[model samples]
Target: MANPTTPTASVTCSALSYQWPDGTSVFDGLSLSVGRGRVGLVGANGSGKSTLLRLLAGRLRPSQGSVTIGGGLAYLPQNITLDTTPRVDQALGIAERRAALRAIETGDVREEHFETVGDDWDVEERALATLGSLGLGDVELDRTVGRMSGGETVLLCLAALLLERPDVLLLDEPTNNLDLVARRRLCEAVDSWRSGVLIVVSHDRDLLERVDRIAELRSGSVTWYGGGWSAYEEALAIQQEAAGRTLRAAEADVRRQKRELEETQIKVARRQRHNKKMDAQRRAPRIVAGERKRSAQESAGKLRGLHEERLDEARERREEAADAIRDDAEIRVSLPHTAVPAGRTVLSLRELRPRFGRLLRGDLHVHGPERVALVGRNGSGKTTLLRTLTGELEPLSGEARTFVPLRFLPQRLDVLDDELSVAANVARLAPGITDNHIRSQLARFLFKGARAEQPAGTLSGGERFRAALAATMLATPAPQLLMLDEPTNNLDTASVRQLTSALGSYQGALLIASHDLPFLESAGITRWLLLAEELQETTAEEVRDLLEAAAAG
Candidate 1:
């Protein structure tokens, strides 16, 4: 699948800029070049990574400047929907050619049929091979997409994009909804990409680790990191370490300067007091005394000014040093009341069967404060199982019960009301809770003072997520059984860390459904449940091995 001979494909932007109609400036005069190789685009939420991808793909017009691609470009958007009416071959843009080939085989030597086939008489073969490469080999060429699972559709879309044979490929969060198996297939595609400019925007760590370089988009600018995610993190760690040392030195300088200034003031004050005493006691002639006093005053004034100036300069340097340090604030909240005892029976799923998805006759007993990870391939009933446990979707034929207060944060995060203020939404969920108490708790989630009163619709992605999580955790009756479905779906790396920290304070049972293994491990997941036809308890090592096995298969 790889082209060993490196191609000279590239994507370049010159003084590019973009702004929404709401006057939100995403980028201003941004310029960058992505040469042939795999490039991972990473950034915090609202950092304009997606905007840059759209501008490169020509899906969005830059407000100024230009975008230049060395060759053909194909973009795989974050959200994809396929019409069930079209056959697989048609989706791959080879239906007409396949039809023409069939016509020629039947002795219909029409000029148009030959023209359609052209030199690509093996177009169908190529299409099938590409599908097979993406683990969709069993997908029939004539079958509609309606019969396929979501993961299958994603693979189909990727297969179609590969069929185009573009020189530059742009993928925006391609693994967002893909299961473990589909993710492996996509990873293989990236691994085999030896030529052209491939830029992918994803939060998936494994996918990011496969990149040749990482271009971090921050503050409307791109900073390049050689190698992959691990390299980038190592560089950042080294930089932060150096920054910490610099900051400490700057702070020490400020303190020393301040101390010198104070000593100078004291010395000047004592000198003044002595001069005044001598003058008042008539120790010299009046004229001489006045001259001496003026001289002493001027000298003290100069000394004070000199010391003050040094202190000011030291403060400025300290400020600059502090600015160099990143603000990776973690949410530290207390959850003493949410803690459950060791003997508590939190949840029980007896012969559970969701209305849909792959989970069948699921049976599990969650006791005490166990932290469980619900992992499975796409369309494996992970979400269905969560919803069934939440009672949103009734089980088809089994019993589902929760003994303690439970809360579920679904993938969509639709728990918050758009029209109400964040504080108001939390208050609505926590009826009878005092406003003072709610505001105090919200402050722990980083919503202090006026921020708590901001409309839910106006909050940024990270802020909204924190607010939703705050509400879920800080409900009227504290939730002892918390369930999160793909909690880190669109969260940036820093935000993911913040989420993990918040979960650290959670003393109750946690049942998280996610494909992000790193986040699960960070969240202190005590047990791993792989959901398919049945929920199977597995180890983290085996869960990780699933990727390698899937790719090999």
Candidate 2:
């Protein structure tokens, strides 16, 4: 159900139903209304958060419903690409107005220039202000898009949307690959939003914390919660606690009803035996005895039916109670083979210079089972360094060496073959491993039995990440050092927790490149390396300070 009374700048979807061309249904008669405020849309992977955003943005049409918008709208999708040849002013959509202003400044006095400029004479000023708000103030209007980093481009696109000044704005996974500074800038933009319907679909807990409310999309329905992520979590905790209690009570009631039914049956049997004995002892006539037996049988039947009905009702209640509880299973696996000796050298780098990114030269050394967190701004050579270490990319001048077996899981997760099943993919990675062994390990990663047979391409975002991780970690020769790049880019919170749980079992050296500070802290990172012109050893606290200081400057 939706609130039809929402005024201007609101969005309403009525009986919305959407199905993929393959006949996979996403939403069925789903409806919700979003009024003026910041609304954070949160849900599990494959729960239709992105799809719902698309529908609202008018990028996709519903199969059988209506979407009504009370005002103008703009959308910033998860993946963004801009023409590299376009200048900053052109991309921001203010080039024409700027040219018109220039023409008038030159004293051309053209009527066409006046018409194009209209009331938006301050377009360039507003564009510059918007770009500055998104941490792009240093960029010049004449700069080409090709020179900007991927993250900068995303921010630039967002800047374009902001310049539109639409009544409604939709953003999907806006912070996927953004570094800490970029994230902070995006957060500031979200905080400054006012007087419109703002809906963002994202798994970033920090971003969600800035929202006015939360709209959770689950099972094709929207459940509204007041406040941000913390409040929603607190409310859900209370609900689950109550549900657990009800389930336990229902189970006890079922057991009680079963016992009562058994006792009643025993009593009826004894009474029947006694009645026959009494009839025989009294030497009653045959017709009289027959009538008594028939009446007793009828009474026994009614009593049995009553107890059976009670038991049935109790069982039904138990089922309903059980259904109310959520089962978000965790991944639990052990990898003892990955353990390294305390004094053993795991990795070493000497004056290494990757072919791309900002690092000119760097030196590093890893020992034992040290877990290192790679922290830096986007385009700071983190990925390039990892690739060079893995021998996937050639370095310009120095050497990178690993003393033990290692594996790298890139952000793209291209390690998996889409055509293969989860189990088959693991088998492909770990040659000579038995099918039973792979299946058993896959089960620990939460891909049990038939689920392991699902094609890698068909898996959802979270499931695919788990599968890729499993394949990388479960390979033969047992990688003593594991590396991952932006592993939590688009993962939901539950999935992130699952990944952490899985990593807990790996007794190896870990090098993870990520901007997610909370995750890095939770993963027990023993060292933090900042990627800049040089590789500097730092602490988590220092990393946060550096990002904040950089953003402020």
Candidate 3:
């Protein structure tokens, strides 16, 4: 529990508005207030979640409104790129130690406080302790961050934020790259944290469930809902259902009104024609002629007025229906595959070994068509083995063979060019394809129309992943072997589900090196290549037990 005397922080924004230089307005007159406890921020991609976080962190100033953060704040960004040359401990406490050393050297602190600066050992020890609390206990303090896995980097950032212990903690997709175990550890840490307000921006249902309240951002407005993920989902479902009903009703009403208006106009036209015919036949009867003409004109005018009014009503209904449908333009992709027979031996490694100076060594054999998951703690040489198998790096000894054409989707989406448009990237990857063909292929991967024209740099993480897959899968000859390295790093639940379904039905063999247990489970992985202190083939149950043991320690 947090202490009563601990300074409480309140965040408030008034009539905030922000627009990018390209005239894209993200928020308009948005206002929100948050005070103490854990709050979950939920929104679809491009709903201003990141933008709002930047503003709250004071990284960016609001264009039209004021934001007040009542206390010191610490922010953990979604993608944390680290200086790989530095050790884990050094990276974790770099800012803190630098500040302390400056204080001492500049005489800003009294000599009495010098007792706190005995040696660098204390700083490293403190850093390790903080990291350990976040389940990074086994991470070597001297190990370079570059050698660490994506999951490890995410945990390191969390450790840094924990060490900072600011009055307010702002985490933007903190669990994006984390595996199930690491995610659970993070949730536990947040649950146990004291003396600070926590604001988490994430689309993970499980993570959101841990929060005290949920705030949803849609159409540049934030709606606060009390309770956890379940409650928030329930509320959203109800709202969507109501909106759908309203939309259907409006459509029906508009259709009926349009028919009635058309019928009325036809009747008016017929009456005018009849009046004209009657005047031509009886030109000598002036009184009757005048009366009939006056009646016809009056009727025509009334009919026109009614038609206009009905049209206006129908237009208003259409607008209302459009507003009610949230994110109607959401991309849906269909992953089609031609039947490809799996070979008995997809990948084989015999007496394989790899080493990093005197640090690590491994002997392994991996057989294929089997969904073998490489499981281990951070810095446990999972990536090394992967690199060796792919021939990106040579093994210290032994032989590794990939018998089929392999497609590697790296953790970083390294194949994509940020400056290129999504369509252009696809075309560059698959050269002989025509532009129309490329567009059609991209559409299957959910990049459609203007979205396909957008630069890769402007896309969200999920979108980028989809685009990468689109480019890779649409090659002239698709790879028979698919190797994914942390494939679900930054995907939302929906995207993850879609990928899982596609992979589940894929005919090609899969070799996934990931810490995402849920993803592995969903992909129907039964064989496990446990890569901890040693290389061994084990059952899924064995792997789970090992993970539990590691997490317990």
Candidate 4:
């Protein structure tokens, strides 16, 4: 669906068509227009959301179509890598202007310096303001990019974009790498957008809630919803309910039509038999009898054709109604062996300090099937702790131990081999498991039949995540202690729900490190650990309060 075009700023794609080099079509004859407002672009992973953004940003050309923008455009792609040598000012695109202004202040009186400075004499102030808005105010202008955290780099890149003041801005998964604090800053930046067209593609529900409208891209088309995430969900629920009723009605109609057709055939057959008997009893001339039989057969044929056509139309209606309903499958699997006893000690940490991040010392003990949420700010060592627990990284001082079999699903999801099929990856992880059993279990993860045969690298973001998850949980020893680091990073809303559903069936202890509070809460986190200079036990509310207080400061 296309909204009203903005007089000041507009983005429109006309008869868009694109295909991969290997001849797979991603979009065909797709078109959409955006006016001046915040639009949350949502879709399943690999539904062409990123590709569409790239096309709009002029980074990629469509096979056949035209993208017209009313004004300047800026794009922030999903994966960001900034040069380490550049200072914060240079990264923000204002270093040269600042230099020119400084030269003039030193009484250089050079025409070239004045020309470089131009009318933007306050560029440095604006740059600082943008940086401050993105939670980077403490960062000095001359600070090297290498010194900043991963989350800070993302916000820094966004600050640069804001400095451009483009008429149309596109952000693809902007919150993926950000911590809670940086995410809030990004949300504030989105909330402050009052002009131009701001289109952001993200799986972050909190961020999506800040948008003016939602544009759901599905099946190579865009559907517009009036409000934010909650509103869109409500509207979608109503639509699905109506579609279900319509489907039921259409199915009934089809059955009724089929019955009518059968009855008609039966009645016509009986009538023909009775007419033949009557003709024999009348003993009319042979030619007259033959003509009467021919007419009866033709009439029966017409009646059958009419009923058949009605049935066909009813079936068509049923198909259309079914198409209106979404069938996002949920993962459902059971592993009795993974269940930890109530008194079993799952994990123990003793004054452990990881090799990375800011955690100085950590001591924790977990028992049974406890669900723990590892919450902290960026650079606070959430990932470091998970890695240490998994034995991928040795603790600097103390030891981390897991009593039961364990598995770790990192943010990168590098467990799967790129060249192997999904089923093969699972099989490799789970030695001695029958291929039939592996395939059956994979089906529960929504990788049914041929999907399980696809190479790991060929899968989409959501698919890849599911594939990795299946390999992790279905390992031979049955991971009684399952540790995940940022598991919901790039998953769509549906995929996130699926992950939660899958975890619901998991009978093992969970230790998840994530900044997504909603997801953590839904996962039934029994304990929350705040990882900073030390590991502190905290609650979900307390975590939120701390983040908010920090942001306020």
Candidate closest to the true structure, highest lDDT = 2
lDDT of 3 by residue, 348-454 (tens): 77666765322144554334456778776655676677777788988777778876667788888888899999999888877787999888767757677888999
| Tens digit per residue, CA lDDT, model 4, 1-553 | 1122335687999999999998999999999989989999999888999999999999999999999997778899999989998999999888989999999998999899999987788888988888888888999999999999999999999999888878888999999968899899999999999768999999898889999999999999999999999999999999999999999999999999999999999999899999989989999889999999999999999999999999999999999999998988899998888999989999999988899988888889999999999988888888878877888887789999889999999999999999999999999999999999999999999999999999998999999999999999999899999999999999998899999999999999999999999999999999999988998998999999999988776
> Given candidate 4, what's the lDDT at residue 513?
94
Write down the worst ten-residue block by lDDT for model 3. Answer: 330-339
Kindly list the per-residue Cα lDDT of model 1 for residues 170-240, writing each as its tens digit.
99999987877888899989999865889999888889999999999988999999998999999989988
Q: TM-scores of the models, in the given order?
A: 0.93, 0.95, 0.83, 0.96
Looking at model 1, residue 165 earns an lDDT score of 80
The lDDT, on a scale of 0 to 1, for candidate 4 is: 0.92
Candidate number of the best TM-score? 4
For model 3, how many clashes?
0
Worst 10 residues of 4 by lDDT: 1-10
Model 2 CA RMSD to the hidden true structure, in angstroms? 3.0
Please give, for residues 1-553, the per-residue lDDT of candidate 2 as tens digits: 1222335888999999999888999999998988899999999999999999999989999999999988778899998878999999998888988999999999989899999998887888889899999999999998998889989999999998888877888999999999999999999999989858999999998899999999999889999999989999999999999999999999999999999999999999999999999999999999999999999999999999999999999999999999878778889998999999979999999999999999988999999999999999999989999999999899999999999999999999999999999999999999999999999999999998999999999999999999999999999889999999999998998899999998899999999999999999999999999999999999999999999998887
Where does model 2 exceed 4 Å of error?
A: 1-7, 272-298
Residue 259 local lDDT, model 4 = 98
- Model 1 bad stretches (over 4 Å): 1-8, 281-299
Which scores better on lDDT, 1 or 2?
Answer: 2
- CA displacement after TM-score superposition, residue 431 of candidate 4 (Å): 1.9
